[model samples]
Target: MAHEDASFTDISIQAASSHQVWDPFVRLFHWAIAGLFVANAFFTSPKHDLHHWIGYTIAALVGARILWGLIGTRHARFSDFLPSVSGALNQLRDMATGRRHAHIGHSPLGALMIYNLLVTLLVIAGSGWLMTTDAYWGVKWPKDLHEIAVNWAELSVAAHIVAVIVESLRLRVNLARAMITGKKDIRRDSR
Candidate 1:
């Protein structure tokens, strides 16, 4: 028991000595977006302040995330995970053929979804922002656009959840849990 404890301590020290992977800002932004999204879905609606507050929170979180992607830690940078169309298609092909491999960064399909999420949030935030400006107040166009953006966001989030389920089952690991903990444990050479 004593020997096992000592080995655990050594591993903890080694992990701590390793370079910090997820910056605190990135982690905070991630959880903030996730929480706000959930709150918007369940605790807010168009008829209440809760809805507006949640939306603003989500927008702020997305804005911060965009800024962070431009200049955050290595793993959190957009360059680390943005997927090309061909890459995404190839990942789909690999999935169809059971040839997908584990990766350190987002898989191609997942990366595409990440891009979609960011873009959708931007549109949503823009529309919501317009609603507050005098020039766009009560504008039907902005309302319609915001609703469309929300729909897209909802669909993308649903797809993301489904993909997470599929990946968790396929990889024998919880991807969502990794998002929360910022540590994914997979064979180093799996990909």
Candidate 2:
């Protein structure tokens, strides 16, 4: 915050003032996608109607989220979170030493993970949707594509967990709980 970096300074100030970051719709979409993904993974059978329904649910959630990012609350917007590689490295340097970089939205690493999860979810839903169509029925490649995308989604989920843990430890805040409540506990800058 003491430095002259425009992005860092602006985001730091926003973080200092951010009362609530994630909006209700964004939060709803996120948890909805998560729940349906879990249900799809466990309860799915090859030809079962539930699998198709779950896939459609995930797709719809992703579509809504994509729209939300354009007009959502401050931190929920993609413009607020996505960062360049150089900016991320600078943030990483501060993180390495346990410096308090009050990021308003997703951290550099988390921004990447957010993008990753969304992209993966989109691919998963797209391929799964394709598999349900008459042209793709009993097709080897579309099913295979769906599987790969799902695997990537699993990886992204794991990455999300690790990122939450890292940010929690670094910021000394319970981030998972924050995601649910859409609030972060941080001291108001007294400076």
Specify the highest-lDDT model's number: 2
lDDT digits (tens) for residues 89-177 of candidate 2 = 77778788767666655667677777888888888888878888899988899889888988888888987888788877766556777
TM-score of each: 0.80, 0.85
Stretches of model 2 off by over 4 angstroms after superposition: 1-18, 187-191
* Model 1: per-residue Cα lDDT over 39-84, one tens digit each: 8767776767777777777877888788888887777888877656
Q: List the residue pairs that clash in candidate 2.
A: none
Backbone clash tally (model 2): 0
The true-versus-predicted C-alpha distance at residue 126 of model 1, in Å, is 1.5
